[model samples]
Target: MFDLIIRNGKLYDGTENPWTRLDIGIVSGKIANIGDLGHEQARIEIDAQGLAVAPGFIDTHVHSDLLCTKPEIHKIKVLQGVTTELLGQDGISVAPVSELTKPLWQKQLKGLNGDIGEWPWHSIDEYLKFLDKSNLAGNVVYLVPHGNIRTLVMGFAGRKATRNEMQQMRELVEEGMRQGAVGVSSGLIYPPNVFADKEELIEICKGAAKYDGCFVVHIRNESHRSLEALDEVIDVARQSGVCLHVSHFKVAGQINRDKYEKALAKMDAGRAEGIEITFDQYPYTAGSTVFHAILPPWMHSGGTSEMLERLKDPVIRQKVKEDFQSNLDYENWVLNCGWENIIIASVSTEKNKRLEGKNVLQLAEIKGVEPADAAFDLLLEENAGVTMVVHWGNEQDVIYGMKHPLQIVSSDGIFGGKPHPRLYGTYPRVLGRFVREKKALTLEQAIRKMSGAPAQLLRLKDRGFLREGYWADIVVFDPDTVLDRSTYEDPLQEPAGIHYVLVNGELTVKDGEYLGTTAGQVIRRKT
Candidate 1:
């Protein structure tokens, strides 16, 4: 007998094809059949009348590295119909830390990944095994973080790696791929990663390429220098022969808005030149990340503790302000988008929690200090654990990226107090705003970006399609009413219209509520 049967639903099948009226049968955690299924009998049956049944969404970028261990609190992903998440993004994550560097990463990543007290694993294999033991809400995949590999070989050093050190980092990358990482990820604007030269990146990409793994990167700059940064990564892809996926691709700042078409053309040209290129972006103009990322890369050279110490030094603070005024080489968020456009999103301490949603300008007034000093003090007070949402681009630009044939959807969501609405709203917002309202993408095309496209990019074998003989990871939602309710101010709200979700043929969400079933598995790259 079939384990379950979903009836009377229109299936999109994740192939960018037209939806067809069909029923699906699931058995032993796999899709057994897809057709009329009227004569099928099952242990359980779901009447999905008037619902769109498709492959469960795969979030291509997420910071759920530490949060995945707590399935109860991590249900936000599944509630939005995400059945699998690609973690270890932005080149910094929990695993592959040495006893010495563990504390450093813990401190550095607290704002982005959260402080989960003590981490249990220190290697890629151990971390994956830990996820296997945890009660995960959805399937999890990983990319070997470039920062972790670099810190393992050299502890957050600001200088370029020596040849021997580069070899060591490459070896670590190979070890991670052998242990099942599907790719390698780096956040070039973030420190340690920022210190890496292009040659180092090419070497690292070669390691991932050896395993047929993709190279996912948050490029060095997303504003005025965006074109150059794009060229740099494209060159890395050309040299290493790795598939390249840019994370949260955008041309930020009003000054650089004109570069949007140019950036897309650059990507097109790269693809035409035989370099595989794809990108994932949240359907929003505002970008979110740790607030400390605003500082010049040199200040973050010694790690979080040392950076925090430097923040207290008047000389160093003056130097930082000077760089903010003079430096056009780095991302320099505060310079591109004014301090008023950068709003604090999260903080660790109770005293600073009140500052969560306030911009640095408001924070300056409240603290009776200059905007720069107010931000600097907050970073010190929070021990460098501060996150922010920077209003960086326009809605039209977001739509432009969405319509690109090579683009896929990803939340790029980071969670904490006053998190970006994208964390809770990304998938539904696309279905509602972009598809239903704006007409930027059709319903079928949207589903393909969120589902099949990401799955293909990550090389997931069987989870991204509603096909017979595939795993039964599915989402059933009301197309007419599907919409995201979360907003920047009230970011904790869940989405509407997602009624049923299944992971590995097990029902995890029923009637728009989580069923508390931990049916997720750790999906490792096939070596």
Candidate 2:
């Protein structure tokens, strides 16, 4: 007898191959058998006659570290059939934080990570323990946040690291790895992390290399200096002998749309020299982050409080606006893409709630102020606690990114209010729009990127493939009819055609409805 059985399904096997009719039996949450069993008995059996049975999807890039604090909103992910989420993205998260500095870091990260609720642990192991106490919608794997490490040693200072500071940073990373961080993540485009030089990055990556971990980077720039940033990451990988994975890889701005091939060619050249590199991209043309990211790196120095004070000065704010306006030669999102292309996604205060769906340009025109001034004032009012959807990615880039052999799928999903549609639509949209409709890729290839690819990247020996003896994390969906219903207007709408989902042999969603189960556990590094 088996705990559960799925019969008559077209199995993709999490690889680039045509589907084959197969029977999968689950016993004790691991795949126990994978052949036709005459007169097999089970407590529950699902007749997936026409559905595609594949490994549960893995979202490689996400900002769920802080948002996971709000469990009620996790249904958006469950409905999309995401069985695992790579948390602690962009080098920002809630572990390894000093209790003394945790309050400040939490305040500064509100725009990017949303609010950090009652889950407060200052060390990586403690954070994991806190997660274990709660039921999650999906499994979560963690990266040692580089920003948190930097802040622990330097407190958001904007400069090169001193020798002593460098040593301390390395020890912190080593400690995190000892506590089971799979790798270290860097957001070179963001503060504190941006302060470190290549040598400093190499040192931390070396710590990760000790455990056979990869260096996942949100590269420094994806616009004017995208190539330069790629080269820097490549150089770090080569020098430190660490594997590299780029997060949310994309070129931004209208003028930079054509740079994707060149950016990719640079990575290919590095790969030819024997450096292992992979990148993850969402299926959407627009990306979301804190609206405060529009400011130049220096403006963010001295922490969030200081930045707010600077924005209060009319002369300083005007100079900042002028600087952005005159810098169209680079990937300044607002300057190159215009404020109208940036839609406010959320705000922390009730006074700004009405602006969530509107663009800064619209708000500016209504308030009788320049768009830049309006943006600064809003950030000042909200204490920089704002998020936005920036429509800077080109459609051609998104398509080619999906087609790249080295590219994998991730949602980079953010949740709160009027969130990016990717939060609800990524996996289904890939199956529906890319595979079934446009034929950009075969269904097999799409499944490969979402399942096996990320599973391998994260080094999970027991998940990401529907094989005997592997954890029974699986999804059954009507490939032909699976569709992402979420749109830019109704960003919170649930998806369609996901018939069933299971995590660790437990049903989380059945018959297209969530069962409100939290069967997920913390995924740790094998070493």
Candidate 3:
């Protein structure tokens, strides 16, 4: 007898093949058989009625750092057919925290990820176990974040690391990988990380290379010097000989729209020269991040409290406003035109609740200040806890990236407050808007991007495909009807047509409702 069997489904199999009608048998949470198993017996069974079935989706790029407090985030993902989540994107997360740095790290990360509270810093391995023990609906994987280590040793300084600090950074990377991290992720656009020079990253990459881990980077300068930034990361791969993956790879700002193809060619050149490189893109054109990140890097040098203090200072505030006017980084970086382009997605304080859906320009209009000054004021008022969605990337760029063989899908999802629509709708939106509507990618190709491609990237042993002996992570959905319901204004809405989702042979979502079952495991890197 087996644990369960899902029968009569059209299986995509997570490859470059058409869906084939098949019956899947599950035993001990692994796929025991495919095709006819008419006589097989199981403890529990599901009749899929020939609806499309594929490997459960894997979100390669995500920021679910608050999983301990909000395991229901699995509902948001599993409901959309995501069975695994990779966290610790953009160089920051809760793990590897120390008694000295925990408070400071927590304060710094609040704006980027919603405050999950000051949880005690255990080792990264124990943190992952804590999440699994919380019973999240699906598996969790993580990348050792660069910012966490930097903060632990340097405390968000905007300068090069000392020789001693560099060694410490490398040792931390080794420690995190030893504790089961798949790789290292650097948020070069975020502070401390922004200050992390190429030599520092290349050395860390070499350290991660020792363990066969990929270096995931959110490269510096996605606008005016986007291609130059690409060259820097490519150079890092070249110097270290580590595999590289770019996060949410896109050119922001209106002026740089034409540079998308050139950016692709640069990455391709790196790939051609034998640097293993790939990228992840959400289906949507609008991207999300914390509003404060749009400001120049200098403002964030000393951690959140100090940053907030500077924001409140009239002289320092003028400098920020001047930078915005001078178009140093803000104008051509995230917000293309003005502050209104950045719609507020979330705010931590109830006092700033009304600002959640409004842009900085709108807030400024309400407060009778310039948009720059208003943004500064709001950050101070809320203690710098704010997130925003920037409507900037072109639909053409999104499609261009998604069509490339090297690129895969990732939500870069954040949670709580008014999160980005991708948090709820990334997978379905691709299946719905891009695949079904735009015809940019065939269903077979889209599934591979979400499943097989990511599994390969993570080097998973038994998941990401519909082959027997793989873990029974599967999704059954209606292709004709699957579509995202969330929008920029109402991002909390879930998608439609995801009928059933299974993680480790345990049904987590059935008939579009979460079963509240926690079968998720902390997927460790194979040493």
Candidate 4:
């Protein structure tokens, strides 16, 4: 008898094809059969009479590197039908740290990646092994972080790598890929990574290319010089021969919204020239990240400790304010969106807990200080551990990105106090608002972007499809009623219409309720 059988479901099969009536029989954690299995016997049966059965959603970009070890928080991903996720996004994550650098990264990344107390692993292999023993809620894959590699070779010094240091960093990249990383990821806007020039990126990318891995990057700039930034990465891919994937592709700011078409044309031209290019984006006009991202790159030169010290100096603060007003060179959130659009999402100190969910303008009035001073004081008080949501774009631009042929879906979710609604509402929001209401994408196209497309990009085999003999990671939801209930104000609310979810042939969510199962496995890149 089959271990489990799902009957009478309209199967989408994770492709851009129309749904078909079918039944799936699961045995020993893989799909044993897919057909008219109405007559089949099973130990358990789920009658998905009106639900759409498709491959489980694969989040292409996420910051769940540390959070995945905590089932209480990570189970929320499965409740929204995410059975697999790609972690180690933005080139900053936990792993491959020396005893000296570990504390620095923990302090710097506290707001972006919530504090997880103490860590046990120092290498990517050790980190992945730790997750294997942590009883994860969903399958996870990782990318070797550029920041970690940089800090390992040279402390977070703001300078280009020497030839010897370059060779060492390249060796580390290959070592991580050999340890089963799917690719290499870098956040060019985040320092030590910001210090890396195009030559450094090309050198490191060649290592990932040697393993046939993709190079996923949060480009240097996403606002005024977004096109130039795009060209830089495209050239890196061309020179290194690594597949390129842009993380959360967007043209931020009100004025830069018109650059969307030009960006797409550039990507199309790159693809036409035989370079593989793809991107993932959340369906939102606003974007979220650490609050310190608003500062000039030079301010973050040495590390978080150095940056905190600079925040204390009045002369440096003046320079910072001047740069905020005039520096169009970096992704200046202050110049493009203003302080009112930057809302504080999370803070590390109890004194600043009340500041969470308030914009800098509001904080300025409450604290009786200028907006820049208020933000700087919070950074100092919280030790650079503050996160913010910046309203940088509009709905029309979001819709346009969704309709792009090479685009995929990823929440880029950051979990903490008053986090972005994308943390809970990304997939259902697309199914409800974009597909059902706005007609921006059909259900088939949306499912493909969430499932098959990411699988193809990551080169994941025997998953992301409903084919026979594949691993039984699946989701059943009502297309007509599936919708995200979470909002920016009530950001913790769960979604609706996700009836069932399975990871590796085990049901984790049944009848819209989480069963608290940890059936997920650590998916490694196959060499």
Q: Which 10 residues in a row give candidate 4 its minimum summed lDDT? A: 252-261
Tens digit of per-residue lDDT, candidate 3, span 205-282: 887898989998898877777888989999999998889999999888778898899999988888889989999998
Local accuracy by lDDT, each model: 0.93, 0.86, 0.84, 0.93
- Model 4 Cα lDDT, one tens digit per residue, 1-527: 99999999999988789999989999999999999987789998999998899999999999898888888988789988999999888889897899999998998888988877898989999999999998798999999999999999999999999988988999999999999899999999998899999999999999999998999999999998999999999999999999999999999887887788899999999999999999999999889999999998998899989999999999999999999999998999999999999999998888878988899999999999999999999998888888999999989988998999899999999999899999999999999999999999999999999999999999998899999989999999999899999888889999999999999999999999989899999999997
TM-score of 4: 0.99
Off by over 4 Å in 4: none
Could you tell me the C-alpha RMSD of candidate 2 in Å?
A: 1.4
In candidate 3, what residue range of length 10 has the lowest lDDT sum? 328-337
What's the C-alpha lDDT at position 238 in model 2? 97
Candidate 4, number of clashes: 0
Give the lowest summed-lDDT range of ten residues in model 1: 65-74
Give per-residue CA lDDT, model 2, range 1-527, as digits (tens). 99999999999898777888889999998999998955798998999999999999999888887655445778667678788888877787777888767887788777767765654688999988888777787888899889999999988898999878888888888889889888999988677787789989998898888888889999888887788889999999999888899999999876776678998998888889999889999989888988888887778787788889999888888778777978643347777678889999998899888899899889898779989888998898888899999988777779988899899999999877789999999999999999999999999999999999988888889889889999888999999899999999988888999999998899888988888888888888887
Query: TM-score of predicted model 2?
Result: 0.98
